[model samples]
Target: MDGSIKVKNLTKTYKGDVKAVQGVSFEVEEGEFFAFLGPNGAGKSTTVQILTTLVKPTEGEIFVGGINVKDNPEGVRRNIGVALQETGIDSVLTGRELIEMQARLFGFSKKEAKTRAVELLELVDLTGDADRPSGKYSGGMRRRLDLAMTLVHNPKVLFLDEPTTGLDPMNRKAIWKEIKRLNREEGTTIFLTTQYLEEADQLADRISIINQGRIVAEGSAEELKRTLGFDAIQLTFETTEEAEQASKVLYGIGENMEHSKEEVTIYTENGTQFLPELVRNLDEQHLSPKTINVKPPSLDDVFINVTNEEKERV
Candidate 1:
């Protein structure tokens, strides 16, 4: 598949010399679900804004739908749809009104715009509430309406910035279903930025995790998880001091060893095979763990492992 979105050496700086985005580069293939996974203030939104033409970049190249961003921002805009985190529909406008207005703004004729509005309301499963004022709709309903408005013009590429943030589980699932269908059925390339670990792991075909303005890790969920090459054995001690001491006593026995408060997590190959040896090490050091559990590497671990620069290693 061709690259639907391409970004190269992209950098953005604010007035105080703070680098919001630093030489970041990645590409999203056509009809692929690509996620920019990061915590807040990690430049996910900045990068999205630049690609959507709402904000200009300080340096590097960008293209959307085969159009150069800098040379033809307007042309790029025409081919893309953006649904930002905040839903800003007018309180008095009904769901249908919001969608119809959006379709008309994109140059749809009066009759065509009305027909398009009805189709979108059904698409987002809001046909039952089509005529209800947005202010009266629940949070999930409002979010769905905002999403439908973005789809009025049938954009080739869709940019969703934290689309399901602050939503309940059912509501988040609702939004995910719609977007997944768009990608599968309509072949729309999706660019999503999210802080939710499960969101990226479940929805993205590939993910790039960013932290402190740099791309820390990039791969499919399974590929990134495999990088750890070990299971995590978590031991909880009764006291923080014991946890700290246990970390030192078991230093070279594990891969990336780290302790926080009363918990020490040891990552190593064959975790089940290493449990007895681990207990012996603690016993020899006169330390006792209150509880122990083992789990495979997850996206949450990948996030924490990459974001923390001072990783304790064997």
Candidate 2:
């Protein structure tokens, strides 16, 4: 339970006055699936790079598994595994060769390296293609191999940056299952960064969203979604006229009543409790909706709201 990661006041500035990351701070508890959610160039990669010792931070402190990164970068590296956005495998090498080489680099003996390589290939479900040249592998296959290579040393903390990007649904789900297994069974701390909202929602125990080089919001997916503090009730009508009429009828009942061509959405504090009243009010006005749906706010909604609010301030 001591394999936690901590970052304090992390900042990184580049040439040409580019602030890639600014005053970011967060903590990942031991054995936690922590997600960094953000769009491209939102400092997600920059933060990961700094954490993994691929880049030095301009200012701040970083600790992995309770070892200070700046004080002992090699120690930090020893405790963590990284699967970056780009695959760095040698295509001419077989998948087994790549994993064996990684194990060797981590100081495994020749015999031990082969044993670890076989274990990892099986763990990633690439045992069948272990001897295939990486150049002949598909994109998904290559990704899985890269992930296996990262695990060759049994790292206590794992960093995955957009691990499922460009993968088909089947492959993405396969990777998700592996990641969950690693965290659940191995007790490895996972730090994942991705723009996929659903990925973060499904895999992360807690999510921190970055925008414009700063942390915009941080919470569990449900907590962040509940920051809006309302449920949405959507009403679809046969005509725009009906939607407009329905909006007037629901004017004071819900906040932020929105209407489009043939749909209306209202934000209510307690949508379930208010739904019946809403229906009765609309029915009294002869404005029955074609369909009604009540749903809790989603992580995507929270992301959009937080990023838009940041944009407006800028």
Candidate 3:
């Protein structure tokens, strides 16, 4: 009740009786970095909108920063900072002007707004480009500027929706550094919704994956990976024919298996223990692999498996 976020039995239904979100419930401790991951149209956006007070829920209780969203939407908004994937950056305004305007919107005087702008520009490493029109800023630079705008009021909670969706790898890393700093140095609670699974795996203290309007899994990256409960043996053969053959031979030996044109990936418990038998089976079949790499289950595997299961059920 006194924490960053708490929701119970949250549901959202639209005009056509579309159940966008169904009985979703979760919590985020103050200062915790939480990630909400889902495929598109998995009710992720609708849930965030409700929490941020941009949309109303059809049923259930929702609270953010200790305020009930339905009862005091304005109070909930005051304690939250939201930087969405499509958040606009006015092309005509300079970075400095934009940030100053945001500060003023929160009731800062001219002098205070200017000072706050200077501080934020420094915080996001945009001081050098503060005077340039935002239209000239790079994608990454614009993202940083947008993030700085969100923090103008120093809200207790920050919501970031795909903050690095289209940036090149180098720019994405830069944004990741800034976001990590917000959590570590400023002790800010971050609720992140990212298209990049690696970003969520690396940045969030805990992750919740929603599928088909319901939470299918939730945990730390490692914990979620463990949920799959198997190590992957990634075997690459000399040819597509060989790879297909390997899958046939390795069938029933693994908990599950998948293969492509030239790669056969077998998932099984105790990969090391299975290696000896795998080698023998390949030798017997006269199949020589180009590479055989063993790895623990990755976040990608967990996400795909969970969502794929949901699809199968539907």
> What TM-score fits each model?
0.90, 0.79, 0.83
Q: Which is the winner by TM-score between candidate 2 and candidate 3?
A: 3
- True-structure lDDT of candidate 2: 0.88
Candidate 1 lDDT over 1-314, as tens digits, reads 23399899999999999999999999888999999988889899999999999899999999888888999998887888999876488999999998999999889999999999999988888999999889999989899999999999999999999999989999999999999999888999999999886788889999998987889888997887676447889999999999999999999898777689999998887889999999998899899999999987654565567755334432
Candidate 3 residue-pair clash tally: 0
Instruction: Give the lowest summed-lDDT range of ten residues in model 1.
Output: 305-314
- lDDT of candidates 1 onward, in order: 0.88, 0.88, 0.87
Each prediction's RMSD to truth: 2.8, 4.3, 3.6
lDDT of 3 by residue, 138-203 (tens): 888999899999999887899988888888998888889988988998888999997566788889
> Which 10-residue window in model 3 sums to the lowest lDDT?
296-305
- What is the C-alpha lDDT profile of model 2 across 1-314, one tens digit per residue? 26799999999999988999999999999999999998888999999999999899999988889998888999888778999997478889999999988888889999999999989999888999998899999999999998999998889999999999999999999999999999999999999999887898889999998988999988998887666556778899999888888888889787556677998888767889999999999989988899999987554445555765667789
Clashes per candidate (backbone, < 3 Å): 0, 0, 0
Root mean square deviation (Cα) for candidate 2: 4.3
Q: Rank by TM-score, descending? A: 1, 3, 2
